[model samples]
Target: PDMRAAEDAGARNAQLTKPPGALGRLEEVAIWYASWRGDPRPRIERPQVVVFAGNHGVTARGVSAFPAEVTAQMVGNFRAGGAAINQLAQAAGARMDVVALDLDRPTADFTEEPAMSEDEVVAALAAGWQAVDPEADLLVAGEMGIGNTTSAAALAAALFGGAGGDWVGRGTGVDDAGLARKAAVVDEGLALHPQAKDDPLEALRRLGGRELAAMAGALAAARAHRIPALLDGFICTAAAAVLEKASPGALDHCLAGHLSAEGAHGRLLQALGKAPLLDLGLRLGEGSGAALAMQVLKGALACHSGMSTFAEAGVSGG
Candidate 1:
């Protein structure tokens, strides 16, 4: 992020219709977009929501209420424009794309084996990078892997230096017992691949789902393309954690779209130094939070660029 643009935006905001700091986080939103874009009057258009769908072998542990096949099923639903993210994207006026990562190879159970090899992770990342259009104004990366929360929690624990159990969450409406089982599985996976604790890419290779790897890759590509990224919930944050580790300050191009209801999500966002745009107790991770926040960003950009200046409105100035 560019400090000069933010300072310039702050100066510009003070000259707008409202008093200084009256807009609160909306002002911050404008500043952030400006900082990323190096444009005091930044505008967002051509918003795209990319859903990365993959299967998680850990679902065999009965962690999630939905089965692994549901990952593929939801991809179909996303194509049909019937999923929650689809509806949210429609409301937000954003285009949505779904990518199925590693459909040929079955997902490895991280508790027993690496979730994806280095080659697989690299390939998935490349696919994610290619998915982002250079013309995209903003990119929102979402995940649809069953049991991905477990993979995400494991990645968080690995990068953040915590017990896997501490980062685990009930994904897809897992019950108390299912949550416990998910924690145990993540712990065991971490134990099996302990090197992930010190290496971020290693963590993704060992514990991250295909969707997560792709998410991380897409974020890296966004930074390269200078497009701001709006991240979803727990899963998205965890992937961002890995991206941050791989490339320092990578998340400077990203916005924490919302604070998920999952307990670990706050920790991940705090680690990433991001303040979410919305806090609606949203736990759904299919990029729904990001899509909704895109709407808020649109509002913020509109107010920042459209509101008349004090001089233009013939009003008093500070």
Candidate 2:
């Protein structure tokens, strides 16, 4: 972050027409954005939303209420502009891209063995890294994959030191029996991949899916380019968590976009020390929550860059 730009933006905020601290978090949002953007007054002219889809072999365990085919089907929905993320991204004037990562070849079931080999995981990461647009001012990475929530829970538990029951949730509306099965699967994976606790990247390779790895890659690329990102729900946050666990402060450029209805999402955010921008009970991942939160960013930037200072308006200084 550019401390000089942040200082300038903070000073400008005090000079704005409104009373000091009137805008609350919006003021802080603008200043934070300015620091990353290196612009005392910045506008989000090019926001990009990339949704990556992949199939997870763990679906064979009946972890999700939906079948694995839904992953590919949803990618079609995204391309047709019929998904919730498409609408939200359009509403925010964000350029949307959907990448299907070898939908036919899902990751191995982590409960039985490592989810992906080193080569496969690296390929998935490369797909995500290449999907990012360096010119984009902001980024939101979303995922679509059957049983991915299971993968996410496993990754979270591995990186954060938790048991299966602590991280498992009813992903895709799984019933009680299915949820129990999912928890068992997570515990089994944890036992099989004990080394994941010490190596965050290994946790991703051993327990995460292609789409999850891709989200990690995309966020890393965003950080490299100094593009601020809005993180989505449990699955997305779990992917970002791996990056942070691997390298402290990896998520300094990201904001929690929302708190999802998923039971473990708030816990994950708390662990990451992120205060979400919204709480809309959203669990429909595909970057929908983050895309909606982008409007809040736009409003903040608008107020920061468009509003006149009291002096500029010839108003009396308070």
Whose TM-score is greatest here?
2
Q: List the residue pairs that clash in candidate 1.
A: none
Query: Model 1 over residues 173-238: C-alpha lDDT tens digits?
Result: 888898889889988998999899889999998999888889988988888888898999999899
Error of 2 at 82 (Å): 0.5
Overall lDDT per candidate, in order of appearance: 0.88, 0.94
RMSD of each: 1.3, 0.7
Candidate 1: where is the Cα deviation over 4 Å?
none
